[model samples]
Target: MIFDCLLTADAAWLGGRELAGPTAIGVREGEIGWIGPLPAAPDATHREHIEGVLLPGLIDYHVHAALIQPEKLLAAGVTTVMDLGWAPAEIWPLVERARHDPGLPRIHAAGPFLTAPGGYPSRQPWAPPLVAIEVDDPAAARRAVEALVAHRPATIKITLNSQAGPVVDDATLHAIVRAADAHGIPVTAHTQGSGQTRRAQLAGVRVLAHTPWTEILDDRLIADLARDTTIISTIDIHGWGEPSPDREIALQNLRRFHSAGGVVRYGTDLGNGPLPLGVNTREIAALTEAGLSPTEVLDAITGAPLRPGAPADVSVVPGDPIANPAVLGQAGAVLKGGQNVTDSDGGG
Candidate 1:
């Protein structure tokens, strides 16, 4: 196949193995057809060269798009994004509409945050009725899960923030988890305050929306979740404004979580406030400060900061890899669905 573009990077993060020498990746038919040393470019085809690095497109597992549109995500090097919480009736149809929108980040989302009656979002003015489900009983929890599954979410989001009003009981949480499991979907929860993480873990939650934000989880709690679940690092979002009590707790919790074998994922509560509309540098910095190396920090945003999927998208630093942790935040070439989406100039 004749490649429409040929990328040469001094270092290329090819599916997790960083190549040390010159490497060429060929894109044909909008997918990576070949990845090897540069052969002669097709005489009839045009080629674009990126001077720095090339890696897989970055993935943001949590973001709210109520404000930011989908196009910005692609321009920012995000090829796939998963919405943590949103209104099902409105967001579902919008997500369906976005399917035909070319080059938009592939969106896999949750219907809404399932919380207890008058939970966290219920008290916030911006928290609309459709943005979260307030379930106070096992039956209500089961109904919420069933309704959300019918809406067709990739996963179910539960809010276990006990500081705000009431959180769902273990029975109710288990009901939601069972209902979601019946449909083969996992549950991701926004857990905070005392025993919230433990409760979620015991109930078989697969992911935590934020690293515990009300207390430093003990070694036992960390090990429990590390053995089974993932914690989305919304570290930057927690410390957004002035230094507050919640931010301090979240920071401490994250430090402990990373210290344990617990997994971490890069997520910015993008639409929560004035956070960057795309891949967040603050988020990267926060994760790096929390103990992640340059590679591990990048991996958090890619697929396997904790698990495995593809290589975190590459960023070429002029200096040695060990010296330039900041370069991981620098956007580089992105490959999504194995196709080159942007070149050196940050355009296709």
Candidate 2:
């Protein structure tokens, strides 16, 4: 491969283990070509040795891309982001920009939130028209999934919240899941209320957009979820600041979910409310409260490869092991597609 920049460092947590020795990674065509110990420098070779840690491109499983511009995400060390909910028409242009712009965050979108006729986002003041599709029947549910898939959505999102009014019925929810699965795309649902959670589980949804906090899940539900789907942690976005009822519910549900060995992903639900644009420290602290150690939390964010069809180059913070959960959001440094963007500012 034709290489451009070379970065050498002490030890980096490249997901699994701490890589030893001076490592050199080759970047070509905006992707990692080769990564290993530093090779002997050729005569007059050009490279930029980033001073701090090198982590895999951080992936925020949940985020609204519009909340934070792509440039800011890249500068802050987030290379890839999953826009959980947004107007596809408005977001398409930004996705195009990221696709071509080397200095911007790589974008993947869910198109919009699939909801019932009078669902949660329907009445929200901030909800964009292009961001939510209201489906009240099985046919409409199928159509919604097909529409999102037509836009080449990475996954499907369904809103099943009673608080928002007229929630999707079990048949419609199942139809959405079936349609998504038929196209080989997993369905992620914004499930709320005790009945809704149990219904979503029964429908074989691939992921719960957030931990079910409206009510505590029983052992049966947790075990069922642990075996079938991954739950994303938007725990910090629950209460924002004070100890409210929602926050308490989320914490309790997360505790049970983690104990059941359910797959968890670190997400801040950025742009949902008043959360920080970048990695939120409060999010990590909440994970710790749910029984995730620093290592487990790291694994959740900087974990293994996602989307086998679209592989992403991974690297991680080089040093200053995240002993304290409070500082987990302090991106030590970063390496994405073999390119070091954080330099030494990652604080080792």
Which prediction has the highest TM-score against the true structure? 2
Off by over 4 Å in 1: 1-7, 15-19, 39-47, 241-245, 304-323, 332-348
Candidate 1, clashing residue pairs?
A: none
Candidate 2, residues 1-348: lDDT per residue as tens digits?
446655566645554433346666656555555566666532214576666555566677888888765566666566778777788778777778777665667788787888888788877888877678888899998878877777778788888888667788888988998999999998888888758888888998988888888987888888898887888999877778668788888888888888888888987777778887666778878888899876678777755532222233444443544555454355555555554545433212
Off by over 4 Å in 2: 17-21, 39-45, 305-318, 322-328, 332-336, 339-348
lDDT, candidate 1, 137-248, per-residue tens: 9999888888887778988998887777788777899999999999999999888778888888899998988877777788788777777788888877765744767767
Error of 1 at 272 (Å): 1.2
TM-scores of the candidates are 0.84, 0.88
Residue-level error in angstroms, candidate 1, position 270? 0.8
How high is the lDDT of residue 51 in model 1?
70
Task: Return the top candidate by lDDT.
Answer: 2
